[model samples]
Target: MNKKTGTAREAPFDLAAEFEGARLAARLFGGESAGSYLVAGRLIRFDRLPVGDLGLLTVGFRITDRPREKWTRRFNQFKYGQPSAVRAATRTLCAAFGMFRLDGDPRVVVVSSVPSGQNVVRNDTPASKLASALAGSRGWEWLPHHVTKDRHPSLTGIASAADRDATVDGKYLAAPIGGEPGLVIVVDDFCTRGATFTDIARAIRESNPGWEIQPVSLAKTERAAYWKGELTNAHIPDYLDAAWRGDPAVASPFF
Candidate 1:
């Protein structure tokens, strides 16, 4: 505890969580669990431990390898804000972190949002339900926070970087979280370039310093770039660590 501030300091990495989280991610990606997920096309998985200031970010669903193909109708269903689609994606995300054990009464920070193109949009996306489910999970005391909102236009997964940033800039709309800095999980339904997650993380960091933040997205669309070298098990953790630290060798394929 900080004697003066009387708040807990940032907890060190739960190397076990990193090891296990990476293992689970690799397993899911290596296998056919993520239907229509092509390893060749995806770059960042947010499976590694939080690097310096950025937390781990993982998308629940992956964009299909082909433009016409899909993991299922769920992507379309999700765009329509269908509950079943949200639940399925939530389960996938929860499954990924189901075994991740952490310390303290970590708060679940949810960023509920909708696509601008949708005829109908609901604020309570998978993030709300995921937080609820996570509260009962991992045998940890999970506190739910007042939800954040994007209430903005969702991307078509085809926007240029400048355009995407412009559309998403200052849209994070910071919500002050009052508590001792500990652990916070930021959840979103879909991420492209993770602009929302990045913005949200910045807000939380500014308001709640020393808190370990992890961002989880239900789905993400990214450009394709396959790893030419072998990403063997023996080197997963080290490679990820290096990647997070800006190592081109690992970042080339995984980040």
Candidate 2:
């Protein structure tokens, strides 16, 4: 268990067992199978990260109305220029990094999050600030102003797969600026459909195909929340429904 966040550590054995069980259940009951697969050649973790994918991952689940609501509110405060929220997020990230065991002296690079809209400047998002803080704490390199949202294909209100795909395709990624490639960690406060990470991965792969891009968010929505509120055999789905209550089309699928 992670002492700082009071969340259980993602053990390799447990993950493997869970995956095996999921596969077995799928074979027996005709449900969605489980395993680390790729969307645009990037491994996606709807529920949990695979072993060795990334250490000291999420702080908590971001399911709507869950205990993570407080964290989400704090993150929004930081986004809207709250100093205390920034400090809190920084401290939490630092603590999480301490818990993860790094191998050798891996060259860590933090990706700057894209702005919300075309008029907004890059490196101004709250997630970027969190990444900057984490990079500064470990003396790791921080790449800012590297990516930006080219269009305002607002994925906020829409809940259809077609709309989500269109929004994701609208995102633009600038070529990496740093010298050599290393482990690229993209930080975000919340992940609903993972379209942001997917777009970022596609951009990175286009430029530096060999670099490993790991998407680390503070919280992620539960897979079961995407379905009809029934979680008897909950498993992460390829496309998730926008389960947030604030969403105009909460019942719509995110991606």
Candidate 3:
């Protein structure tokens, strides 16, 4: 308690505790499940699973509400080589990967795909850059341009999953053998219908049948209708309370 204000002092943010609370709330309210998910229609297996049950592994930064002005700005900053944004993005990756116990390993390869012939000087491939940084931090190998997009598919404009899948040319998308056989984590910035990731994972697996493949992203659209209900809102205070306590679980993953 603060003597001057005669009220209890607020505690610092606790990441782990907040995460646990969020997990509990999700369980109670029938929200997003925690842990990695097998890519639909793919038989590739992983020796280690990530912390989400969705079709792909993801680190939830925030609810991806459409017209997310803040997220847009941060993504732009990260794309344009802003130091603070890079650090924050890197931290998020570290946190998610760490939670899945993926750090300090040589058996994992982080791969990112970009449009072929894209100008690297103009920072056109932001996801690749982010994936490379994450790999370096984890002491893992990074293939920034493992797969190449033959044509510029406007993924954002494509509404249907089938259309998105049709746009991806598997013949043009290629993943080379990286000398070592291990799990390959395909990293991307955003996931909508997951068509792009699915195509990439398929291409990699077809090329290297011995390697395990999985797709991970920083943010994924919340497609579950249950997330829109009042239960999510009701648990906000609990998450906030856990955050204020500075629980180790709530601590920043970058630290």
Candidate lDDT scores, in order, read: 0.47, 0.53, 0.53
Query: Which run of 10 residues does model 3 get worst, by summed lDDT?
Result: 38-47
TM-score of 1: 0.56
lDDT of 3: 0.53
My TM-score estimates for the predictions, one after another, are 0.56, 0.62, 0.58
Return the lDDT, model 1, position 183.
62
lDDT of 3 by residue, 1-255 (tens): 999989664443332343454466557655333332222111111112222222455444234343344544454555456776665665555544442443234388888756434522123455765687668766777776566655555666777766666776463356577577787878777665566666677777778878866676665544334353421212123222233234465455332
Tens digits of per-residue lDDT, candidate 2, 45-148, equal 33333222232244444445443355455546554677666655555554444434344456777775565566333555667777887777667778776655
* Candidate 1 Cα outliers beyond 4 Å, as residue runs: 1-55, 59-61, 65-76, 103-123, 138-151, 223-255
Locate the minimum summed-lDDT window of 10 residues in model 1: 34-43
Q: Who wins the TM-score comparison? A: 2
**How big is the positional error of residue 151 in model 2, measured in Å on the Cα after superposition?**
2.8
Q: Following a full C-alpha superposition, what root-mean-square deviation does model 3 have from the true structure? A: 9.4
What value does the lDDT take at residue 222 in candidate 1? Answer: 39
Among residues 3 or more apart in sequence or in different chains, the pairs in candidate 2 whose N, CA or C atoms overlap within 3 Å are none
* lDDT (10s digit) by residue, model 1, range 199-228: 666666776778676665655653334323
